[model samples]
Target: MEVNRFESINEGTILLIDKPYGWTSFDVVGKLRSLIKKYTGDKSTKIGHAGTLDPLATGLLVICTGKATKRVVDLTADSKEYIAKIKLGETTPSFDLETKIDATYPFDHVNRELVETVLKTFTGSQMQEPPAFSAKYVNGKRAYEYARKGVDPKLEPVPIEIQSIELVGFDLPSLVIKILCSKGTYIRALARDIGKALNTGAHLVELRRTRSGVFSIEQALSIAEVEKKLSNMCNQS
Candidate 1:
């Protein structure tokens, strides 16, 4: 039985990784694939990430190798939770700090009470448009391309649900929030709409994925740590 288990070790492996901000999902997969190949000397150990993470956002990234790659879709469809900060009184093209600032205005009139009311309104199912600078495809091209050419694509609004959104902190234009949402929810659009409702305009200031489906950031391992474990295992042999 021990020998059988050892023989099946390469069949599948699920690795949870704490993805650093500014690294694309593909970048993580590529890095891990290289690491796995080097460590196990298995050139065909297929590696893939379960979901995409924006460059500005960081947190749990689920990586599956070998037969585990088949389970990525189920993992991605699971609900996700995020800790995010939305800045009032500013609007950006990308809906986050990465894009060009479109407008800015006074937000001193905004208050906690008003924010709570707006949060309540964001609940339930509603149509949400993804950011133009997102990976969403449009006419065989990325939405960002249309945006870059100053041509606004007639993007269709998709349905999404906000299970819960609560304000955790507020400091003038900066407001920290916790969101539990269904799959395909765009926090950037939520911030934009929240700003609109508050009459101050808003953009995402910071964002982090704390949980996704059954996986949490707490269980995520760093690339360095994974490599260290691999090194130790080889040394033992």
Candidate 2:
């Protein structure tokens, strides 16, 4: 069922937001919390996001407010879809552009056919290691903390499913792909593995979450739009 935007603060509702790049998932929640408090004068209203998207990525973010926050676990369990661009011939410790390139390789041997075949190998359940610069907790500290200190935490691999991988576009060194995968699947890790398979190092240059479960970017509102709506609501009250 679609939620009514004009519902009372105590009435739960789900919000689909087009999270802007450079903004963390927690940043969205914080902004919305302030808006709700200003509009409804309810400082204690609960607001949470279903999943976490990296600050460097943009797109659909499922935000739950009021009683709807209770379903966050169920919402996060759904499959996710993403469109990413990987740059061949180079790799970074963080797997994405968040970190500087640590090494380079020759991409002369990489081609369209080779990429298609390599993607096929990843279209099933497999064990994947999360990136070192990730939110994964280790001994109560974030994995990135250990990575920043030059400590290799040696995170264990976990099972993940890649439902589908479609090659959207491919140039010699840059490849664009659309992926549908189960929860916990990391595109950064996939980029790294693809490079390894091609005998050329690679890393993610860009990434966007297009869908999460039943929510799609098409139905999501931008931060500015949400803020404007909340402002109007405040005036109406």
Candidate 3:
């Protein structure tokens, strides 16, 4: 694959990297910042990421450097696609495995047909309440900050658009779904809502961002690959 982006990395360019699981969005930015500085011999290079992916999530991450950092806002506003694994019959505090299970429910009644119907209810424009364990601000502090201390902040329901939802696989309490949604949609929250609609509890087990705007995971390189490119750049410099 020809990646012209890395060629102008020092000058300012967009870099698409596949973010690995267990790595925070900031961690990726920091690593890349160091790599670009070390390889291009430009410590002053500016770097930023368009959207933030949870540490538990893995997939495409759009990173920008130098003057390209200015485009982060526009990039973050783009719609995204994700493949998420949601588990029914159990609810967690963070709406994902990041926290302990808060409750459980009977999922004996949930079926593929019911799930397909429920997913349609979530399609199109709707107001979604974000997970309490989220980065959303409340009273000048992060909502997760309050959630960490066992306080539930007043998180507002934001308007979001779910372009499409496809039930890729479903067996018993576990489900695999493909979602195309607008910028503000939270898969965790969606999972919780789906549980409610089905009279059960649910939480996110795994999530992977597959696409953002025109960039797809297929076009992204891993951190190691990026490092190799940087090393080559250093040799050239």
* Model 2: residues with Cα > 4 Å off, grouped in runs: none
Put down candidate 3 lDDT per residue, 1-237, tens digits, no spaces.
Answer: 223377788778889989999999999999998887778778988889999999999999999887888999999999999999999999999999899998989999988999999998989999999998999989899999999999989788999999999999898789999999999899999999999999999999999999999888999999999999888877786
Stretch of 10 with least lDDT, candidate 3: 1-10
Which run of 10 residues does model 2 get worst, by summed lDDT?
Answer: 1-10
lDDT, residue 203, model 2 = 96
TM-score of each: 0.94, 0.97, 0.97
lDDT of 3 at 230: 80
- Report lDDT (CA) for all predictions: 0.82, 0.91, 0.91
Candidate 1, 53-105: lDDT as tens digits: 88889988877777877988998888889999998888998889888789997
Name model 3 segments beyond 4 Å from true.
1-4
Compute the lDDT for candidate 1.
0.82
* Candidate 2 per-residue C-alpha lDDT over 93-141 given as tens digits, one digit per residue, 9 for 90 to 100: 9999999999999999988999999999999899999999999999999
